[model samples]
Structures are given as structure tokens and as C-alpha cells.
Target: MEKMKLKLLYADLQSDIRVIEKELETALDSSSHYLKDASLHLLKAGGKRIRPVFVLLGAKFGQYNIDDMKNVAVPLELIHMASLVHDDVIDDAELRRGRPTVKSQWNNRVAMYAGDFIFARALEYMTNIQNEKAHQILSKTMVEIVQGEIIQIEDKMHLNQSIRDYFRRIKRKTALLISSSCQLGAVAAGADDSVAHHLKKFGYYVGMSFQIIDDVLDLTATDKQLGKPAGSDLLQGNITLPVLLAKNDSAIRPYIEKALSGDMKEDERQVFLKKMRSSNAINEAYHISNLYLQKALKEIEELPANSVKKSLKDIALYMGKRKF
Candidate 1:
């Protein structure tokens, strides 16, 4: 399981991660039963906890201090959770991690309110660290992520969009936050500027690889693996690297065009997915993701040759080969 893999990768930080898990649960205590339940639902569903892992790892660059580092780790995860709640509403997603999404259980409005409340909690947690630089970095990242969401909405159904556009969007959407986690974590623990920069760059490369592989999995993985349809991204008009590459084939172009036009029927969607799974697009996407993995390794190579570097390097290798 991915959870087991993460634990193995972070074997040394097990106690710190457990502390973070407990903190996540306690952070949601609220007077409103509805808000409390909605937030708790998402928390209990379980996730890879990748952001928090990065935050903790970044802290290792400086003197490892769970107390100060947690202030950064908790909110990085809270921001990610808040984004997922809002994303479910925007995507009309019914399930997340094999359970009902907040929007599905309650409604869109409730999901929005829940997301806002969690974000507020993140800000409150952030304020606890009096570092103005950390606050500014996080604030800018929040704005960029929102802009990425808006661009995704606007670019959806536009199959001809440049590959550059797709890369930029994913960078803002996924990579920025992860990069911030590394940077902010280092800053929180008083890492030197050079160390923080390397960690931030490392996070960006790994984050890009992670999301690209996720997009690839969306096309190739089973419904059970994804906890949703395999072609959910295409069904939702979110063109990823696989879709873009597959669209160039004369044999599959029509099906892909139909998907882009928002008219893919059930059978067509299945056929499209099948053809895509067999196509070279998956291979091409993997090659690109491998590039990112290599870049990530290169960035972390500048850090001290220690267990922290070893774990980060292992995680990059794992991202390239991950199934879910």
C-alpha cells in the first residue's frame, strides 16, 4: 500500500508523523457539529500525507524541531485538505478515497463553508509562527493556486491548448504548494537560504512527477484503484499529458475530439480509455515523469549525504513506479 511505502520512506519520522496525525484531528474541533463532522470525514479518509512528509523532511535540513515545524506542517496539510473540499464541489465528485465527499454528503455550499473554515484555521496556525516571510510565501501560493483552478476551468474542453499551458497550470495547481511546504518548513526551522532553495526545487520536481503520474493513473488504473472511473479526467474535460499525446493519433483522434467537445458517450468513453491505455501516450508520459524524477534527485544531491537525502531520493524513485 502507498501508506506503507510512505511510512517506510519516513521510518525515522514515524513518531513525528503520528503527532501530526493527532494534531490534524484536534485542529477541526468546532462548535458547529456539521462543520466538525464534515472536516473530520475528510481527515479520517486517509491520504498519502505527502505535503506533511515534505514539510517534516525540509525541517530536517536545519535542526529538527517538531514544535516549530508542526506549525508549518499542519497548515500545509490543512491548505491541501481545504483545496480538496472545494475541488470536489467544482468537479461534482461523489467520492474521495472511497468515501463520500463533503459536497456529496452535505452539499456544495456546505463544502465551500467547510473549506473556508479549514483555510481560516490554516491561517490561524500560520500566524503562530511570527515569520513574515513564511506568511508572504503562503499567501502568494494560495493566490497562484486559485488562479490555476480558474485557468483549468477556462482551458477545459480546449484540446488544442499548448503543452506549455498544461505545464504552467499543473505547476501552479500542484507544484507550488508542495514547493512552499519545503520552503516554509525550512524557513520555520531556520534553514539557510541555500538549503531552503534546494528543498523547494526538489519539491517542485517531485510534485510535477507525482501529478503527471496521477494523470497517467487516471487513464490506466482501474476504477477501484482510483476510487472513481479511470477516465474521470477526460470525462471531466481535463486534458492531461496522456490525452494530449493520444489525441495526435489518426485512429484515436475522433474519440479524443468527442471527449474534448464534452460529448463522450459511455461506450465511447470506454473505447477511448482502452485505446489510450494501449497507446504510446502512456509511455511518453512516463518518460516525461522520469525526467522530473531525475531532476528531483539532482536537486537533493546538493544536500548533505545523509539519511534525509536517502529518503527523499527513495521517494523520487518510488514516484516513478507508483501504481496509485
Candidate 2:
């Protein structure tokens, strides 16, 4: 099913996501016309807004107020979008979400300035709440997230790294932001400490599973589905879970190793994709993701049995089962 149709299952949070979308547009606007246009270029390129959805759902467990929560919710998404613009520059990425990436559409210098501008705008928006705890959590998450990307660059082409290394990288790169989203939402709504804690844990588990599935789809899904080439990670020399698992195979390891050892032509890239898909690697990776999904569902079960919680549970389940 389409991501939107799937999200409609969580009807309770629909109004909140809509609020966040509008808030995001307002948040990205700037006094400087250049900054406003640049930020809006990335802003108008929509995403699933899953982070804000988690933020809103977590708020439901407390004295939920959309006005109170939008301050946190809008900034969180802008921070994420800012990172994406910078990441495309770092990766030399040409496209994002099936459209020309900011770095590709403009020069790297413009992209960098745009990202910095948006990040500052996000912090400016966030400052309205005056919550030191929220700032600490989000600031630290942003730092660690950047550190994770640096380490990912370090780990590239080193095929023999342990599974623990991959786990460590993804936890910082992907899971922490989602975790913070839930915590910030709870904090904004003045949810009890225990409820905030549980929601944070739930976001972490779901984020991990969600990212693992994304990595898997990088090797398995079509360019149309993924908005990029299949095996793009492999071609980029970023060893993901499926590649790491496939490397453990005596028969399959050498092909992937050989593929990684040098520059990949289009024909070679296609062969690498085929082998990775046919290997037990993808299956094993799915198994690992399912474990995290189960843990995520367990966290959801601990929340009050409200319809919002139930819908969050369904989204977690859907992450494990998504094919594209």
C-alpha cells in the first residue's frame, strides 16, 4: 500500500501532522529572500513526516495540545531536512526523493549555506519553548548523528568490520533522531516521565527496524521505488547490513569483496545487485530487522491501549513487512 494510505490508519494524528506541515513551511521562511527560497526548495520536497507523527502520538499520552507541540515538531523536521541537504553535498548525491537534490540543483556552497541557515532557523524555532532538557537531548543527538556520518565514512570499503560496528553506526545515524522526536513531543505536552521514557524507547526500536529495511531495500527495490539506483549503497562503497551478512558467505563473500575493492562500472554494479539479492544475506538481514520490530511492538504494548497507540503499533508492524 502507499505510505499515505498506510498512515491514514493513524487517523488520530492526522490533524497534528497537518499542523506540522504548515508549521514547517512557516518555520523555513526567512527575512532574507535568498535564505527563504533556498530553505523552501528543500521544504517543498515532501517526505513521509513519520518523525512528526511519532511526536504527535507520544503527545496523546499526556495533556496533548497541538499548539504547544508544533514548536517542537516543526523544528525537529526542519533539523532533519537540513541534515539531508548537507548529506547530499557530502555524498555528492544527485537526487533525493526522486527529485534533484539541493546540492545538485545548486552548487555545494549554496547547499551548505542553505543547510546552515535552516539549522539555525530550526534552533531559533526551538528556542521559543525554553526547555533546557529538550535542547540537551536534541543538541547531543545532532552531534552524535554527525559523528555517526563521519564514522560511516571511516568504515567505508572496510568489509571485515564486525556487526557491532554496523549497529553502532545506525543507532547514531538514524535511531537517535526518531527517539528524540518522541521524547520532545512528550516533553512539550508535559507527559509523565515514565510515558516519555517508554515512547522514546519505542521510537528507537522502530527507527532501527525502519533503517535496516531501508538498507535492504537499497539492494532489492527498483530505482523507481527507491528514487535512486538499486545497490546505490554498494556502489557508494557504504557497506550496509545485507552486504555485511553476504560477506560472511564463503561462496558469496568474494564477489561482494571484489565488487567493493575497486570502482564499479554499470555492468559490475548490476552483477553485485543480483548476487546480493540471491544470497542468504537479504533473508538474514530481514530476520534481524524483524527482531527489532518485535521489540518495538513490545514497547507499544506497554503504552495505554488507546487507538493512537494501536495505530502506532500498526505502523511498526508495517515497517517490518514493507517491500519497497
Candidate 3:
């Protein structure tokens, strides 16, 4: 339902979305049967295509051309898709969107190769733009994304890290790519730098709020809503905002500590999740997500006031209020 709200909010771009969607279908023309299958499996598993939507929205600030914007929008989404395949391997995740992840459907090696192929295809599409800044920003973002994942592995099961640590991680791991999506779209369409800058900041704030809400929903939403077990992040030892806030309670720290120590059994997972959900930690995390949304709204206000701006504002609000 929350996702549907976004689709309705941005319905004006349905035409642009159709073009990007078709581009995604043909983005990877791979020879390897397994590679094609794995890529198709992930692609067929529907997503909101929020990154491409932002790309289209950003392009609205300038000479809107679906043809040119598809270059940026498609490649941005491909880069994101490639990251997800690799992420399932890192987290040993089995499901995404209620379907088996590429790593689970095939194998780690195949998933890796598929990810590489998708990334290379993204670069191939990106090179057509001939914008050095876009290329530089995306390449740097790609490097930072891997670095963020590396740090996630380094900090896994170590619950003592600060909130700033988590912020830095998400900025690289998630926000940067979305930020680039907006900037690349605007720049590609010949929007002025000032407008591009505002949209980039807008994407960053929206991305931050979105990820925080994602972390909160992991603890609060049901398996049916999440399409995976609730509290999967904690189970996988990913220390998210809810876990961090819950740790402030002396009583809850030991459970998290035990979970991090590998003493948490499969059956114990539900008990810990229940406690965290019943606590004030959820509220605290929500407050933070709302804070990010407020910042995102300010960024949107700076953008040219129009239907596109309204849609971007709607997206930020959805992040705060989404059930999953």
C-alpha cells in the first residue's frame, strides 16, 4: 500500500517509467544461460523502481527527454541491482521480494558473475552519455559502496559502534547511489548546477530516511509484510538503528550482546524481536526517520515548486509512514 501511494504520487511519470522498465529488460544481453536466468529472476521480482523515478523527476528540471534520461535511469537501477545480488551473498540472504535471491537460486559464484556482468553493462550504457562528471561521480559512488559493505562486514556483530558509524555506512552504502541518480539525471538533461545540487541533496535526505525506516520496519513489520522474517537484520547481526536505540536500555543490551556473540538460537530470535518492538526504541528510531524527512522536505522546497516537487515530497513522507 505504501508502495502504491508512491506509484500514485508519481503517476505523471508512468510514461517515463515504462521506457525505463523496457530498458531494464534489455539492459543485459548475456550469452551465458545461467547468467541470463539469474539476472532475469532478480529483474522479474518487481520493485518500486524508486531510483529511476528520481532520475526521471530530476530530468524534469530541464529539457525532459525520455530517450536521454533512460541512459542514466537504467544504468542507475542496474548498478543498484548488481549491488543487491552481491549483498545477498554477503548477508547469506535467501529471499528478496518473497523470491529466492540469485545466490540462493543459483550459487555464490554465479551470483558474483551476474553482478559483474550487470555492472559492466551499466558502465557500457553510462559511457554513452559522454559526461565526465557523471562518470566520475558514479565510479566514485561504486567504490564507496563497496567500501561501505566492507565496513559493514568489519563491524558485523559489534554492537558498540556509534550512531555516526551507522550514518557513515548508510550514506555510502545506499544514499550516495540515489544521490547520484538525481544528479546524473539532472546533469544529463542539461539542468543547471544549482538545480542539480538541490535535487542531489533531496535524494540524499530521502535515501537516509528510507533506509532508517527500512531498519525500523525490519523489527516492527511481519514476515508477510516484509516478504522475509521480521528482524532479519538483527538475526544476521546487522546492527541497525532500532538495535542501537534499544541498547540504551540496560535490560535489552545483554540480549543484543548474546545475539552478537553467536549464542542466539533460531527460536530465540522472535523473543528478542518482540521485546524490541514493545520497547520505546521503535519510537526513537521513528523520530530520527522523521528528522531526516524534515530535512528532505526542506531540500524539496528549494527545488522549483511544481508537480515533480510534490511527488518528491510525497516519497519522503512515505518513507516515514510506510508500514514496510
Candidate 4:
């Protein structure tokens, strides 16, 4: 019943995602050959499109104008894409969703220029809306998001960090952009302040849950499913929730410490990953994410009941249950 229920929620947004894909290509159309090609490479690679869909769905609760709503949706996706390009460079990530990342396909200089270019383009595109609140919300989110990345870098390899620190970092790194997505969508469509606030909270909670699940899958899911090695986060020295939780287990402590403290040979890395999978840590982390999903659903339920609201609720559930 739970699995069937989540499928139905995702079904609601499938068509909307198709519409957004077309709009995104149009948005990436640019005169500069290098920028256009680079941006298109990333755009065409595709994503869950969760942020733009949230923006569009939140808009429907108010005025329901696709044209006016698209102004916000496109830039929201562009902002997200811009961040991804930069993130790949910072993480030195070679792949995303099974394809070579921008930095991997091109070079770091191109990735940086491409990210900056798309960010400028996002601002240019969004200016059509003429709403000061939307700008303020998105702009502030962008700044905080960068700060969060900086904090993550600073905290990396420092395995002694607390759970509160992990939550705070993920909130800034992952949740803020998602929260802004919902907020900008509502404000662009002229929804009242209350609806925007609820959607913002909903996005924040779901974003946290979504990222926590992603971290879990980075260990539990197969390499093919993750498009990277399992336990890549730990290998990269970014302490995630499951790692934090498992480190508390006396039996699990050595594996966690060994993974964090040194250059792991292939066999050692596999042993550490196996230990994490066997521990209760992954289950405990999923429980925490489920709590956030429920909180997100509670916010969605507060909105007027409609197919869109139902779909958003379903997406929240889907994030909790996604396999990889």
C-alpha cells in the first residue's frame, strides 16, 4: 500500500516535468556558443526537476497561470543547475546521474565560467517578473547555500562533528534552495503570505529528507544505481547522518574511524561499507528522514486539497522511499 501510494503521487508530476523539460531547453538557448553548448550538456542530462515542479505546483494554489508561473520556474531550475555545475567542481565529482559532470566533461575553468554565466542568465531571465520579494527570497537562498558549501568543506574530514552540525549544514546546502523554490513559485503567482509560508516549510522539510536519503543511498545503493561508488560520501570525507549515527555504535566504531582516518585500500573500503550496511545506522537515519517527510506532508495537507497538493504529498512520500 505504501509503495502503491508513492507511485500515484509521482504520476501527478510526470506530465508537468515534461512541460518543464521543454521550457528548460528554451531557456538555455543562448548566442554564446561555449556557454550555450555547456549549459545544454548539463540541461539535457536531466534531473528529477523537483524544484521547478514545486514552484509550478505552488503557483497553481493561487492564480494558476502557466505563463506567469514559467518565469519563476525556469530561473529556479537554472539557479539549481548553476549550483550543480559549481558543486561538481568543488567536490571534484566526475559523474552525475550516470553522465560526466560539467567539470569532468569540460575543465574547471569552463565549469566555473559556465556556472557564473548560467547564474547571470538566471537573474536576467527572472527580472521579467518584477517582484522584489521573489528576488530577495532567491538571492538570499543563493548566498546562504554557498555559505553552507563552505561550511561543509571546512567540516570535511572532521568526523567529530555533532548531529546538529550535520542538520544545519544540510539545511543550508540542500534545504534552502528547495524552500526558496516553493516560496518564489507562490509569490510569483501572487499567492497570499500564508500559503507561501506553508509551502516554504514543506519544501524545507522535504529537502532535508531528500538529501538524507541521498546520503544513505550513497552507501546502501548499488554503484549502478548511484552512478558512483557506494560509500562515496564517506570516502570523500563528508560526514553524513548514517555515518554519524553508526559511529556511536561501539561495534561499528572501528570501521567508521578507519574509513575516516586514512587512505583506504580497495578491500578496506569494501569492509567499511559492509560494516555500515550491517549496522542499525542506516535504518535509524531513514526513520529520521521519514519524520521530515511526514512534517512536509502535514504542511501540504494544510493547503487547499487539489490534485497538485496531493501530488506534492506523494512526492514527499516518494523521496522517503526512492531506491537510489
lDDT of 2 at 84: 93
Put down candidate 3 lDDT per residue, 1-324, tens digits, no spaces: 666777897889998898888889898767889987887787788788988989888999988989888888999999999999988888888999789999998899988999999999999888888788888888988899899999988878878899999999888888888888888888888898999999999889888888998899988888998889887787688999889888878777877887877788766777788889889999988898888889989988888766688788877787668887
Rank by lDDT, highest first.
1, 3, 4, 2
lDDT of each: 0.89, 0.84, 0.86, 0.85
Overall local distance difference test of candidate 3: 0.86
Give the Cα error of residue 15 in candidate 2, in Å.
2.2
Most TM-score-accurate candidate: 1
**Residue 235 in candidate 4, Cα distance off native in Å:** 1.1
Candidate 1 stretches greater than 4 Å from native: none
Q: How well does candidate 3 score on lDDT at residue 24? A: 90
Clashing pairs in 1: none
RMSD of 1: 1.1
Q: For residues 206-274, write the lDDT of model 1, one tens digit per residue.
A: 889988999999989988988897888887889898988877798888997787677889889888888
lDDT of 2 by residue, 103-188 (tens): 88778998899899889878988888777888898899999999999999999989889899999999988999999998888887
Residue 236 accuracy (lDDT) in model 3: 81
Writing each residue's lDDT as its tens digit, candidate 4 over 71-159 gives 78888889889999998998899998789988888799989998998888788878989899988998899899989999999999888
Off by over 4 Å in 4: 1-16
Model 3, position 6, has a per-residue lDDT of: 74
